[model samples]
Target: MKRKLGAEDLFKINSVSNPQISPNGEEAVFIRTEIDEKDNKYYAHLFHIQLATGTISQWTYGKERISSPNWSPDGQSVAFLSNRDEKNQLYIINKNGGEAKKVTTLDSGVNSFLWDPSNGKIWISSKIKSGKTFTDKVEKEDKPLPKAYVVDGMKYKMDGIDGAGLVPQDSYSQIAVLNLNDESIDQFTTGEYQHSLQAISPDGKKLVVGVNRADNLDYVFKSPLLLIDVETKEETTIVDQNGYYGGAAFSFDGKYIAYAGSDHSYKNATHGNIYIYDVEGKTTVSLTDGIDSPVGDYAVADTQQGISSPAVVWTAANELYFQLSTMGDVRLYYATLDGAIYPASPEGEHIYDYAVTKDGKFALIAVSNPTFPGELFNYEIAAGERKQLTHFNEEFLKEVELVQPSDISYEVSDGNTVYGWLMKPAGFEEGKKYPLIVEIHGGPHTMYANSFFHELQLLAAKGYGVLYVNPRGSHGYSQAFVDAVRGDYGGGDYTDIMAGLDYAISQNDWIDTERLGVTGGSYGGFMTNWIVGHTNRFKAAVTQRSISNWISFFGVSDIGYYFTDWQIGADMQDPEKLWNHSPLKYAKNIETPLLILHSEKDFRCPIEQAEQLYITLKSMNKQVEFVRFPDNNHNLSRTGTPNLRIERLNQIVQWFEKYI
Candidate 1:
């Protein structure tokens, strides 16, 4: 007999990411992440695989966590970043395996770095105090002490950087070149502005960098791309500061540049589009104008850290591939120079992370589904055949009876179609009534897909039927549909979710309507609060890291002030409009047994959002309880401390079990 997935099973799962195919397309390397349950921390190590033999081997090991593994141009050495010396610095080791040697001796560690096209030098992105000779000053000093922060901008600090504290707003990120032969560093692109090197040209003469030259008032979301001359130290604007653009790269021939970003015409609802720039013609074109899907992995992944899948991968100068979030799945698609788009992935599986070989013959993808966790697979582009390469979780998966969800669709009041998934409880029986739990995803803009969701599976394992939907405000729909909820937060989007639930129940006879529960986090949490206040249908509800008052949210959240203006169409200038959409405004109407879950250090949706709702419900003698996780951020469900993540899931499961 197989057992249902439980909270503790999280410890057994391994995370795979950052697959880099060798130059000859015969081998590949990636990072395998694991959690030390006793230490409550995560570790990442390098792993190698041969495409022809499927033989896997570990390259590096120990307590140090490694990331950003890359192969040298000649495939003779592997370079990566590690925290072995208590600082994230660059390290390189031979391909045949041996002890790694440190490359950089900077006082302040490197954030991210990339190998040069010729493998002669490397460009590193690192933070340094902004002043004259600041790079040299930091190199001479010991571990610098914490200084008082005088914040002057709305985008000063964030939660995930170093836990719960305000960060230094004065320190700027600078790019430096390290000569591999001489071990000398030359700091380039200096000033008050911050620069991040994205890609280098094929000849290693020019660089694509994103620079923020604005003063105090402007946000850094729309930094312009600059083409920097490596030898002359001169800069030219490739894409100007009129819109949001980043993740830039030079094509194989250095004639064109491909980047993933968008103009902020629709604010938070704007779809991320892939734009290619012609360096020679001085023109740009959007490759995914009609796709209507987000041009990257917007869906949350449950991993040791928040892993970002590559936004664009170049197969050739004329052909490039990118991942798009459609409905709930992140699928791979390729675009040609003549403006043709086609799917490059197997159907019904989410390509969370992928990398194409230099010859464009094979692609290594981290694929998963409702019943499967992450696994490495090699996809042949022309033959369209996928072969499994890594089986890190095969043993655990074989012993677990996971619940597989069925795809569903329904029409809302406005005749717009909504997509959703319905999963029966584990060991489900025919004609047996089961309690239902409506799971709402965060990023009211993010959609639910056929991906493997650990939380949903745990809910199903605990004997509750699950239903999750992508409403009007979600991606993977029309642009008009995605932008539909910008000004009307709790209006049509709420109706769409409710209609989806009714349709789900009507289609399934075994769902017990009276024993219904609902839960969500972030924007989804706001929707859960909105649903309970507007209706008395759900027997129980749990809101995680939610927003109660948009008025206060404007001043507190990391992106609160501008996010309010972008998503809600209101800011500090319009307090009344902000309050009108606040869920706390209708808290008096809530009678469902409500459980509030929040993180103490969440800068995105602060703990105060949960406090206000908890206090309001308690003052009215309403049934409510509040739970808080210390030292965690808004990513508590996705990438929080491993034990806390399991506890958070248990809290949701126990709350629904008690009330339903």
Candidate 2:
């Protein structure tokens, strides 16, 4: 056989995701994605999985992939948005399926939708003109104009698709009330922040949306909740008591609205807290109180995306069932309007997100831990029993050893306790000294939960101790705790992670601190870059998809403009503040060998940021090399092209082997 580069060899298989049970709760509908190696593309389709008999069936086919499916409350049909007609349009199908019927047509199409309680209507968040009448020449009148000269997606240029369409940024979004009967559309709040999460109240009249009308709304991490009295055309802020408040949902009675929110600090340790606002009483209470859990553990394979849209399942007698991840492991926890919260886990590993049955006796769960990938499981509360339904990755686990993360709590310099997870070598021996790799997570707003990450586990198997932490900005902590790291990015949160390292070295005698190495992507990438510049504690580092210069990052990155303001309360326009928060400001102090791995087409971080770091490191005579993957996005490390994914792993191994 010809010699093959593992990074160039493709072995990734596609997976199914976003499974949602029909309104009637009979069968689960999921989006199945397949990667075609020939074109290096992912094709998605809607598939139906039965809950009772474990039967599976395929629904859509051939031309386009269907996404974001919502079932009509009557359960007779399902509505989905797709790019099937070239422009994304609403398509509906019967309970079983015959042919999907097109339900709406406009110049721009739908991106997301919610069924209007079986009133033959669907509410979608899609681009629409502010005041343009439905009858006007829409393509000419309402089609978006480029807000920024070079749109981020589809490369840096607004390349003409046969001059067929405008750049996506030129494409603006609005929440539209789509009346399925007459194909009539009503625009709600043409006010600016690019509409998202259009949640209709249980009664289907009050629409709870994430709207940003303020000019500085762009500075906000997430849009504040906007409630619209659809019939009266009156709009009001549900609880504009600020700071990134999008994931809002109404209680069964519509009196209480629960949402997932985080304060305005973008420090690396931010985790979202559950907040409930009483509409009638006009009061707000921060739930997920005291029970802090890491969102996604560094032990798991993920892009560091934290929990948004907390899976809130309704209860039989007016209570709400939700999942909480305190201590980095997810568990099924239920709470009522009466203020009582209790555990509902009936067994091992841990419960994923819970699915509540209409009758409240059943809780459908996706369960797993370090040893297992999530499997479909069910808990019958009335029967007081739980059983595993389907094994998702049992075959794969048999081929490889999975690492079990050990919970570790240590104190910060401030005398505050911090939590983290330690993944030991697979066939660990107590006496052997192993090199330790600190795998940090991004999202300064995300977490390092106790999930499974093939990379971290594989690192441990390579005779390295893997340590991941919740380090403050990480979720599963108190809202105030998460908010603590903002503006103080490299301040306290930095001290926490470093303190974590110090504690680990002091506690674990087997860790070779001299052989220490570190690496992370995005904010973690930012931290990795920050760590090397601040101290030479780490011998080597790999910063993937990171921002080295916050000043330049604002204009170049797709999210930099907003991300900067969210993290530090100012954008690059405020160069003084931006520079003060940037890792690049102190680059001359960086002595550690740094490897910058970046995607060629990552709009989120953009390749330029990586280029700047790599160039500066080389100029300073520090051993540095940049590995740029083509045709990849911000998801380069977690969910990128297969050939490139393994290559990323191989590069990390090579970097550590050479430097440390």
Candidate 3:
């Protein structure tokens, strides 16, 4: 008998990502991630696959997590980053498979890296302190054991996977070149600004870097493009810091460089565009000027840790490909240097990551769907034949009853058609009424897409029908639609969701409207709080890592000060406006029983946001419960410790089961 996909299945689920195709396209290397439930940790190992024979072999084995696997241009060696030594260091292994050798030993772990084909050199971006060698700085400074922080600047500390509000830890990430033969490191760029390695010219003469040199404290939005001479280390600003830009690549002949970016004309809701820069002319032109979709995956998730999605994938000097979010999916689009573009992958599936062959005849795509975790597929570029190459979860999935969501649409008040999906309860029977849970997504800007979501699946297994929607202000829509909820929070956005719920209820007789519950995190959490305050239609609500007061969020959150201004259109300058939109202002009206779920160290929407709402509701004699997870961040649901993740899902399911 088939069993429902429950919370414990998280341990059985195996996922693959970051398929790096060799130069000859004969083989590929990708990372396979599995949850170590016994230790409550996550682990990843590199695996190699032969394209012709479909033969697979493990390349590395260890407790350390491996990421960013890159094939050498000559295809003789592969390099990747690992945390075997407690800090992320560079490791290289032969193509034939043998013991991996450590390439670099830096006190500050490598954040990201790129390989220079012309020379056996590696370019890395890492955080380094000033005035001392990184190792000496760490040792001599005797970093204070402070439970308190002396906060400084608009952006002081960052939210790591660990926790938040810990310390005012700051470091400047700069570029460095490491010579493999001599093992000598050369620091190229300097300053307080952070730099990221983007791309190297084909001849390895020029390097492209994304540098954020914004002078003002409040100007945290721009990252300009910089071209550095590999030898002289001289830098030229190819693109001004008037906006954000990165993911750069040079043409095969090294005449033009292609990059992705956007001018902040629309602030946080601006769609990204592709641009080409002529090295000789020193001029840049936008290739995708009128496209309504974001250039890359703005709808992000913490599904797989240590995996990165490249912004632009160039198949040729004249032909390039990139992913864009549209409707409820992130689709791959092929474009020419002249700006013509069309979809390259299937329309309805999410392309998590992809690798193209040198001749551009084939592509290795990492794709996922509503019922699929993630799998690799080989696609013939010309014939459009997509063949599944790997089935990591085939055995486990075969014995489970997975719920498939029905794509639905409804017209909201603003005349825009909102897209959503209604997932039936697992092992459903016709005409049987079931409890409903209206699940909301975070990013307020990010959308619910055609991807596998473990939480929703687990909830469905508990016999709850899940309703999730891409309302206004979601990424996978038009620029105007995404920007609609910025200045007008809790206005039309709320109506769009309610309208979707109403539409779903009207269409399905099996939905027990009286037993409706709601839950969401981050912005979704804020919306859940908002919904309970405005209406008591939900019998139970769980708000996770949510925002309650914009005023305090502006001060405590890692991105608070500026994100408040960018998203809500109000900052410290406008207290009344911020307060008016805050759900805390209306907390006394909440009648539904609320379960507040928060991470003690969530710097994005600090846990204090949850505290304010919970305390306010309790003060009003409302039924409320707050649960705090220690050493977790805003991504508690997606990337927390495996044990905590299972517990979180169980809590939500049990809460609804008890109340609804």
Candidate 4:
């Protein structure tokens, strides 16, 4: 008997990511992650599959988290990052199987690493403190005293999985090379600025990385692609244009480097395009010129754990393969040096990550659709045949009754069509009118695609219709549409969303309009707050990690300083404009029963935004409540504490059940 998908099912699901094809292409290694219900933590282990026999085996096992699995040049061993010890360190294990050996013992551990194709040494990027060496030992004191954090620059903090909160002023990310044969570590790059490791040249003579060395790092958004000589320690600016460039890879012969970036033409809403730079000619050409969509996966979902977007890969044939966001779907694309582009994989599914062979004959892809959580698929590039390689979520799928969303296309007041997905409630009947819940996604720039979203499924299972759409500010659409929300936060974008809801209600009479509810996070959360303040149509609303005021946000959020000017077109210089656009300013007009969910340590939107809204409404004797998850960041819905994620979902369902 199939049961409705429960929030606790998160513990039962297995997530597979970071697939790396072996040099011989006979086997592939990937990270299989699972939640330990006993510890309320996520543990990942390396798993490999013999492509010829389709035999799967667990290569590494532990309770700790492991990530970034890569095949050695000779394919005799596999190297990955794991926190089995204190901090995340690099570890290596033989392909034939044995005890895993710890590689780097760096003080700060490894951020990311790559195998040098020529020298067979591991090149890694790790954080280094001002006065400490790579292998320095921490001296224990009799007692520790509390110290104050002296803030300096505007770019002082960042939001992420590891070291998420405040950044140390004296710390910087540096690059080094480790030789496993002699255990000798060569510290190569040292600087106050951070250097992100992109890739080592095929010949291993040079490395390409992204770094911003501007005088004012806070003001400049450009991280030019830099080519650093391995021996000479000299740097050459490969790309110094006014754009943000990353995910770089060198060609087979090391004659060209392919990367993805945007020129800030639309600020953060700009579309990312793939560009190839000639090593000798020092010229760059945009291969994806006419394609309006971004160069990577912008499909928004909550189920894929440890998933990363693939960089532009260079094949032995000199052609490039990359992912593209198109019409609410992420697809693999093939591009030629002469500027021709075509689809390499099928559409209707989100391809989160993929690895292609050097010969471009086969690809290992991690994809998900409306009903499927995610799984690895072995795709024959030439024949377009796809075979499932991993059955991580097979049992979970069999036990749950998941609802598939239907495609929706409707025209707004401006006559522009909007794309979205509508999921009928689980055990839905034709004559029964079900309450409708409007689900909005974050990144206002990210699209709500045809992907498996656990949150939406949970709502559908609870007998509520789920409606999600990529409004004006969403990707996978035209550049003009994506850039439409900038400088007009609650203006056209809000209308587009309201129009989508109106259109959805009109198209489906089974949707109970009187019991409408709204919920979203980040920018979506901002919109949810805006919706309640502007209209009383929604009977209940839940806002998560939302921004209610742009004035305080400019100083509180990690990206608030520039994001305010870029997205809202206002800054501290214009207080009136910021206040006028703030949802808190219109709090008095809100009548919907609101539930505010926020992470206490969310640096993106910050909890203060929610506090202000809660205080304002509560003081007015309005129906409002607040729930704060301690020690969690802005990513609570996607990758927060396992138990708390379940609690958060239950809160949402209970809130709707009580109010609607």
Candidate 5:
């Protein structure tokens, strides 16, 4: 008999990502990640598959994490980043098989790398210290003395760094080239700015990188694409507008560059568009001009691990292929230089990651659905055929009975249609009412799509109906709809969510309205706090890594200073306005028994947000509990330590079971 999905099922789930097609289009390689329950660690290795025979084999092994696998230009070797050594460094292994060879010995390790198409060299981006070289070595000491961090800029701290959320402000990411022939390395650009290497020209003479050299880097959010000459180090700003840009790729012919970004017209809620730039004509055209959906996958889920969305892929025919998030689905799309765009793959499933061949005939894609975790597939672009390539999660899936979420589309009070999904309780029986949990996604900018969500599945397994919706401030919708929540906070967006719950209850009579529970993290967490404070309808509520006071958030969060100005339309200068939209201001009105979950080092929302709420509720003799996770950042729910992730799920389910 099949059993419900337990918290420990996390150990059995295998996630596949970053599929890279061979240069000759005959084979493909991808990264398969599994959790080592004995060690409480994640182990990833490279797996290879033949396209014609559908045979798969493991190409690499060990306990360390591996990522960013790519085929060399000659297709004779595969290069990837691994933590087999202390830091994540570059490693290359022959295709025929053998032990992988370490390629880069940089002290700081490699951040990203690209294969030089014209020669035996690799362009990489690595961190360089203020006064030290990339190859410099430091003497080991038995007991090192403690050092103090000097007071510096506001961008000194970030989430998921060293578990304490502190980063060295003096270190900067710089570009370098490594010659595989002699194992010699050459440092290129050096500056205080962080450089993200994007793509290299077909001829290997020019490299495109994204950087922001603004004087006040904290306030400016622009990442302009700079075309730099490989030898001369001369830079030409190809996209210097007031916008955010990345994922740039040079066309096969080296005459055009395609990139994805937005003008930030709606601040963080702006939809991303694909633009093609003419290298010779110095002109740019938007390939997805009227496309309302955002480019790249915005489907929020925890089942996928180490997945990198494909940038714009250039075909030999001068066309481009990319992924876009539409109404609750991420689809592969094909575009032409003349500005025509259409779906390259069928709808109804989430295409988390993909790689297309140079000839544009085949694609290796990672697909997931409401009932499936994820797997790799070989897709024939022209014939619209998809063949399963890997069954990594087949055994685990067979032991658990998963529920498929039904589609939900309801009109809100503003005459706008909201999209979402509703999952019935696992092993649900008819004529029986069950408690319903309203799940909210973070990123008030990301959408809840047709993807497998482990948390929601666990909730359903525990006999709770789950309702998740993409409210007004969600991607995969119109720009106007997504930007509607800016400066409105608990206004229309709140109304839309409540209306969705009412609609779900109205359509399904088996929902127990009195036993309602609500939970969310980040922006969703803020909304959950707002919900409990505004209405006592929900019997139980759990808020995770949430914001309570916008005033304090303006100074504490890594993006708080500017994010407040962009999302809340207020800052420290306007304390009253900031407080008016803060959930902390309405703390006295909360009546639901609340459980606050937060990561101690979550710089995004900070544990202090949860502290204030817990303290305020405790002072009033209200039922409230706070759980603090140490040495983890804001991503505790998704990419935290495997043990902590399971414990988090247990906390949420136990809390709802006790109150609701």
Candidate 6:
């Protein structure tokens, strides 16, 4: 037998998403995403488990992949959106066990669905029927039609395991209403407006929807929330609440609306605020004011989802739950909404999305760390106790070694204190200096928290010190901290990182700053590009799945068009601001050995972004090389081919060894 690579040796698992607590809170239903090595496809399935005994009652089967399981409020039936027909559609399964009833017949297929609160209809949204699907398809006008087409609701363009879908062009699941009993569907918010930001009240009489009227649709943060009456389908905008608002939900009683949004009135700062909008009285109050970071983020959980956003649940009552990240660890917190927000912090390594039971006694939280893949946990909030539920991968412990990161903090650029985590070599010596690789995270709005990351640990295992930071614009800190990076791209954040390198060298005389290296993906990648151009503080750099040219990104990336408008507050058509913010603008200044890692099929940052940077740097005679993962998309880090995953690690280790 052949020895397996570390990643292959380690058991790999991912989320099934939205493990719904049964309405009664005594039972729960969830989807489990597992890899089928032989079939070479990711499969997700529904499983019914009693909350008390922890024994599961399997629901769906066969080679067909089913996902997005939503339990009806009554708990007798489950409604899920499946692509079993190749054409995704809504299907109903009963708790008592029976054949699933396919609900609708549409060509483009249903992308998203919601259980109707008042009636038995399923609210669904799809871009299939709205227009013909197209994504850089090069077809001759005289050739036969692509099999992905359908005369009505039949042909589905799924090329692989029927799950890894086509890169979403204009096709996305919007918000709408579908009547389950009569198989009737009603389209809401017509005329070029996508009901993207949407949530239905418990009574099913109201919907809080976010719509982007801007030509740049990806400016989700700039989109405004509108209150719609389910009865009349009438709309109203709550004043003093304009900006980007999504992930909105109605309280169990429907009196207030809770959502994560930012104050768009100001251009320089952004922080996701938790707002409670009084529907009848028309009043909006911002929660987490002093505690929130200026740069806002997005999260979602429906009434059916096991855990709703704590920003929504905590304000009304006393016990509130929310997700927070500082450094690279993402965890869940149960706060006292009544007083000063005091976090009921979890003691484990990582606590991500969580749910509060209807009885307000229990919670189903997602937990994971370096070696521990995502495992389900059941907690009793009052008792201050928790129990592990689903063991996604138990055998991982048998073969692989998990790396643990120690949290580190240092002052940067300004007087601002920044946080990060450092992973030393497995057999690290206290007095010896080692080559340090600095890592940055994406989401300029998201955070790098205490969680399990294989790549970082593998680098440490390869005998290198790894440092990752949550510079300005990262969440979990106060709003001012996150908003600190708004229009100041390479300005403060770059300095913060440089200061961080100095601090790391100071604390760990073991760190060899002269042989130091830096790298990141997405926004982190953008920062990597920015860092190389601005300062040669590190000896080597690797920019992965990153943004090199914002000017071109505004035109090519899937969300770049709108993202450029909001992040820079300028359109790409104008070369002024976009070029100024682009890392490519300063490519000539790059002195570090820059290696570009990218995915061929990436749309989020696009493969061209990497090509542009590589070409520019090589042309300028700077030490640069480009490596592309064929057939891989933007998510190569988290989900990609097993061979490619190990290869990715190998390339990084080799690059740093050669140059750093």
Candidate 3 — which residues are off by over 4 angstroms?
Answer: 133-150, 161-170, 300-302
Once model 2 is optimally superposed onto the true structure by TM-score, how far is the C-alpha of residue 93 displaced, in angstroms? 2.4
> Candidate 5's residue-wise lDDT over 1-660, tens digit each?
889998889888889999999988999899999989899988999999888999899988888889999899999999999998879999998999999999987878899999999549999999988776667775678999987787567877888888457787678898888999998888887778788999999999999998888877766768899898888888887898777898999998999999999997888888899998888898888889788888878888986889877678999999899999999999999988877889998878999999999999888889999989899999899999889999999998888999999999999888999999999999999999999999999988999988888999999999999999999999998889889999999999899999999999999999999999999999999999999999999999999999999999988898888899999898888999999999999999999999999998899898888998899999999899999998889999888988999999999999999999
Q: What is the lDDT of candidate 3?
A: 0.85
> In angstroms, how far off is 156's CA in candidate 5?
1.9
Expressed as tens digits, the lDDT of each residue in 1-660 for candidate 6 is 212225444236455345678777788877776666676655667888888999987788756668667788788889887777887778999888898889876666676667877547777776642343311223347867655533221111221222233433445445667776677666665655555636787787777776666565232345677887877978898532346666676766677776766666544246555666778888877666665543121211100112222334432353455655533445555544333554454543556556678656778777666556567778887786888878656655444555677778887747888987788766678888789998888767767656666677667777788888778877767667777777778888888777777777777888887888998888889999999888878899999999988888876776666667767667846778778889999999999998899987777788899999999888889899999998887777766765676677778888998987
Expressed as tens digits, the lDDT of each residue in 1-660 for candidate 4 is: 799998999898888889999989899999888999999999998998999888999988788888898889898999999998868999999999898899888777899999988535899999988766676666767898967878778987877534457877688888888888886788777668788999889889999987877767878878888998888878888888777888999998999999999997888889999989899898888888899888888888888888765678878989889999999889999988988899998879989889999899899999899999899999998899989989989999999999989999998888889989899999999999999999988998999887888899999999999999888999998899999889999998898889889889989999999999999999999999999999999989999999999999999999999999999898999989999989999999999999999998898898899999999999999999999998899899999999999999999999999999
Candidate 5: worst 10 consecutive residues by lDDT? 131-140
Worst 10 residues of 6 by lDDT: 296-305
Per-residue alpha-carbon lDDT of model 3 for 1-660, expressed as tens digits?
888887889888887888999888799999999889887888889999999988889988899789999998788889999998989999999988689999878888888888897548988888887654434446645675746557556666678744445532556788888888987788878887778899999888899998877665565667888898988878888898567788898877788888988898878778888898999899999888778888887654445455577777776546888888988898888888776888887767788888887677888888888888878888897798988888888987798888889999998766899998999999889989999999999988888888888888888999999999988889988899988888888889899999989999999999998999999988999999899989989999999999999999998888888788888898898999999999999998899999999988788888889889888889889999999998888787877878888888888988998899
lDDT of model 6 at position 206? 76
All candidates: TM-score: 0.97, 0.82, 0.97, 0.98, 0.98, 0.83
lDDT of 1 by residue, 1-660 (tens): 998889888888888878989888899888888888998988889899999999999988788789888888889888999988888999988878788889986667888787898898888988887774424754444867876667666677686766554666667788888889988888877887778878889899999988867775445567789888889968888787546788887888899999988787787678899999998797998989978777887665464242556778887646888998887778899888789998887667778888997667789998888888888899898899889899998888988889989999988888889888899999999989999999888887787777788888889999999999888888876789889989899999899989988999999999999999999999999999999999999999999999999999988888887889888888888899999899999999999999999999999898898999999999999999999999888888877888998889889999998999
User: What TM-score should be assigned to candidate 5?
Assistant: 0.98
lDDT of each: 0.85, 0.69, 0.85, 0.89, 0.90, 0.69
Badly placed stretches (over 4 Å) of model 4 are 161-164
- Clash count for each candidate, listed in order shown: 2, 21, 1, 0, 0, 29
A best-first ranking of the candidates according to their lDDT comes to: 5, 4, 1, 3, 2, 6
Worst 10 residues of 2 by lDDT: 1-10
The candidate that achieves the highest lDDT relative to the unseen native structure: 5
Question: Higher lDDT: candidate 3 or 6?
Answer: 3
- Stretches off by above 4 angstroms in model 1 are 132-147, 219-221, 303-306
